[model samples]
Target chain A: MRKMEFAEAIESALKHAMTNDPDIFLMGEDVHTLRINLLAQFGKERVISTSISESAFLGAGVTAAMAGLRPIIEIMLIDFIGVAIDALLNHASKILTFSGGKWNVPLVVRTSCGGGYGDGGQHEQSLWGWLAHIPGLHVVVPSNPSDAGQLLLSAIESDHPVIYLEHKLLADYWLDYMGTGGRENVSFDVPEKGAIGEVPEKWESLPIGKANILREGDDITLISLGVSVHRCLEAANILSEDEISVEVLDLRWVSPLDKEAIITSVSKTKRVIVVDEDYMRFGLSGEIAAILAEENISPIQFGRVCTEHTIPFNRHLEDNVLPNVNRILALARKFKS
Target chain B: MTLMREKTILELYEAMYTSRYLEKIVTQLWEKGNIYGEMHLGIGEEAIIAGVLSHLIPGDAISTDHRSTPPFVMRGVDIESLLLEFLGHPKGLCSGLGGHMHLFCKELLLTSSGIVGSSGPSAVGFALATKYQKTKNIAVAFFGEGSMNQGMLLESLNLASSLNLPVLFICKDNNWAITTRSNEVTGGVLLDRVRGFGIEAREVDGSDCMAVWQAVETAIPRLRKRNPAPYFIQASCTHNEGHFLGDPLLRFHRSPKKELGAVTGPLTKSVLHYKGGRLDKRISSVSNVLALIAKARAQLSFSNDPIRRLEKTQTHLKDQFAQIKLKVEKKINSISERVLNLVQEEASL
Candidate 1:
């Protein structure tokens, strides 16, 4: 039993994979610790860092994936992923099917998302709302340190393009899981938690394309993701006092939409509200509404409380652009009709 | 021209001849309206692909731009499948999904990308993979001289050398990257700059297959291991044809030897009289390969043909198209009556 950090957990997975498989490589920006690069410690032949050409390097990662190498590409900042959408969406997403099922792009795109402290709007956008809309991509967002490590492993081993979004807020968060070297050196064994600090004991891998039902209630279902998930849970607890009994669904994946779970929840609740950290238009909330409409399930009261479409500048504006516990609580009460 | 063992020399000549032949076929297929999308013809350059590829085994991988058929074919790609891909038929390499820019054969470990210089960093990935797997195979990359100007390629070179992965960087210095000369693109002999980054480097006469092979043989073995990075070789080949096939072949340079009165150095005179020679033998074999392609196309008439496989795919795509049907149905009233009737049928029947 030991303690570790989310960044260290990701490093552990990469280090373990690199140690085990010579074909596995680490590339991106600042993958290695300041003084030591990934290649310096793991030998220069295995680890690589590219020059800020996200599209080119991402395409290179796709090219490598198609060429039988499971390449892990680190897109340092999640905000920068917009620059590499062509490589990710057009090429990486289609490689498996494009090869007539004869090939698979076992590629992992690791990037940082969401706001933490003063990173500002350009650096702190959560792409889950956008990427979840893509068909061939598997979007994984880990709310805590432990799950960050486990989900990173799952994405690394996946035969498809897995977008691992590590929120900057959870960056320095400790992985207080069992089976780790908590000494000066980082540890490997972290009890996989779906959320930060402490989660349920039996929580292993919370299955891809399935929403994690954080709270069960018949009144209304608040669907949300990223850092806002914790706030939704808190809001659910607060709403429990009013006996509103809000069902909180942590949409682990965005793109696949977990249509079945969503339909079942929306059908029973009859009132739905989506609290997402992303913008309103064409985002996760919009997609969920579109899906509900597609499935012919029109809830009596429905609304999506999202951050502003504009960029987050300072501390206060950044806070406003992202959802909070009070916001989730306030949004949940509006469906009392 | 015959330097070493007869078999070795013949391999070099055959590889080059096949590169030239297959490249010509791909170009013709594009010109004949068989293939869709942009095709970067390797018509004016053959030695580079044939030269470096001759040393690689099945496990090794190679990366290319649009003009990568030479390495793809010489590395034992299914010519019929390639031609089918060119024809945009179901039997093609990627089942006509990838088209010209995205030619990939996992069996041969050859991948052609639509984006230029994109393959450089990817070459590093495969080489990184091969090194991690502890396999003896290396990753070969063939890019134009202009690609040297791309930061991604340079980054890959640094990454390759940093990891010491088995990666043979073959810069097909054709002197023209879509009309940009080598001088205009790169400052120095690109190989020198590559060496400055701590990667071993060499420059060879790209027109001579043997010369390019000589450089690759030296670099390949060193690359097939980890720790120190693999060496690089720049083969300077001249593009006789335009950027692509129809672009027109620019008259440049002269024949290798002086022409005599009667025989007049056969390469400078009639090429057919030298038929049945090694080069001609391989070029003629391409026709036989094309014959096999025709046989595969003939199978299209049968139910087993790949084109019929679309029926199976239609079921998988039912959902993707289901919305299209509903949208068309919803939009029918907004359009003309005949157009509405043609497009808005609820059922294909």
Candidate 2:
């Protein structure tokens, strides 16, 4: 198995799609790093670096998509998405339906999200909930390198707009930098929990709206996504020593959510702990809680571990606000048989 | 001197006449309570629509702002469907989801947004696609002088320039943006500012259809070349009506009629007097100068009207222009009548 970083995997998926199709191009603000030498290789026409005007470029990306070109727009931070929300929410999301299915907005908006590494309130925020709320938008958050590569390909191939959120801390840059405390024994080249795998030579798109069961158990179901899924797995390992068997369900796609997996896992475990890195209110946590409540699933214990409503820039404060491994471990321990 | 071929000028006149007639009908509909919502009218600025659109061939795309009915009509968007859209019918372009403001016809490669400065970047995307696909199809982005100050529009200028995309940025400087004077709100010369981005820029009198056509004709060749760059044209025009229907106030800043009155003094004769000796030229006296001013203003307004702008120069083609106007007027009448019937049917149902 060949190891790959999370960002590398995403780049590989984009590079793979671009190599296969001449119509696909990348446009975004401050795309210098992700672009790397891709600009020199692909030429300026394809790997286009746009000015900081998000709405214009996003609108441009939408029009290009409508004109039979697949455009991937990179918003540096999910927080800055507010600037381009009009284009994303209005044009890209509804053009197909508005045009009576004549025009399909094949757009992929890749954005880095999450509150870690001291990027303040403006730079940090996992607003997948906001994107998920909008119809006609596919929200995908990959938990590991392999899924990141495959799911991005799916997003590119999607006939609708896909809001692909990448968590800051879970990316290979931070994983290689921070080493994730005590998980240092694990190989830093790939993610700690997931096995390292090579991207297929051809573009391989994973089915959207599917969940991955990273760790299987019958006692308690830990439902999470993105970076939170890795934290849940780490919590699962810590709870294993205490004889508390846990199931880790990674929700790969946020919208068209994997409700069947949630229902099946929660039915078997009879105890659930929903973990989300976004603000606890009106977000993924609330959505999961609503699903459980409506499903009439009989469980002895049900809890949710999520970040506090406020996201601070300070390292310690942001750490406390986010649902880290320690918080998930404590939450998982509370779910008794 | 003949500025263009009689057929070409007639085509431009027909497009302008269609726009003016349609806007007039829309204004009447809103007044009669048949149409709802904020409606922007392109009454006096039809020359820019005719001149710029005349340069576009089939396969070329255009993106426009809120005041976009002229382009929609000139681009040959189905009048029945567009009328239905205005009335919020299920079979409208956007299936009644978006009203007149969000008129988008993908088949014709035309898209509009109610938001200011929204269409500029979209035009860039269209240009980018044509360039990448080697389609040689140029895209035109039309916005008001007010939107020129918007950062997105400015960014679009830079993006189109650096990439050397085949795009034509047409800014209709109508002096008034809603109620504010564009000159007061906007800083720096519009042409100079765009030229700073290394884009070829031109400024022309928008009231003169011939001038606009000459400018667009000169600029379009560069855009059609193998390695084309973006072009910018700033057309000076007048917005004769309020920003929207029922806009209680009107700004007469730099009124075209007032200038025409100062230059022409009294209407000894008007071109509208041809065919029949109608509209007797009333001599002005010091006592009746205010009445003369009002009369002179009305005559000048009608004289400088886009349809009549070419009347003096193309006197030989007067009959041809009249025929074109009659045909357009007939089409607009038929379309509006059908729309009214549809609206009544919808109301009854």
Q: Against the unseen true structure, what C-alpha lDDT does each candidate score?
A: 0.62, 0.74
Itemize residue pairs with steric clashes in candidate 2.
Answer: none
Error of 1 at B162 (Å): 35
lDDT by residue for model 1 (B1-349), tens:
3244545545655555555555555555455443432356665456677677778887988888777677776787766666656554455677654555567887777887645576788788888888788888788888887678666788888888777777778877755544223453256667778988898887777766656667776665566544546778877655545455433112111221321121223222222322222444433433332233233222113232111222243465445344444453343323223332432352255
The TM-score that candidate 2 achieves is 0.49
The segments of candidate 1 whose C-alpha lies over 4 angstroms from its true place after superposition are: A1-4, A14-20, A34-41, A173-206, B1-349
Clash counts for all predictions = 13, 0
List, in the given order, the native-contact fraction of each candidate.
0.01, 0.01
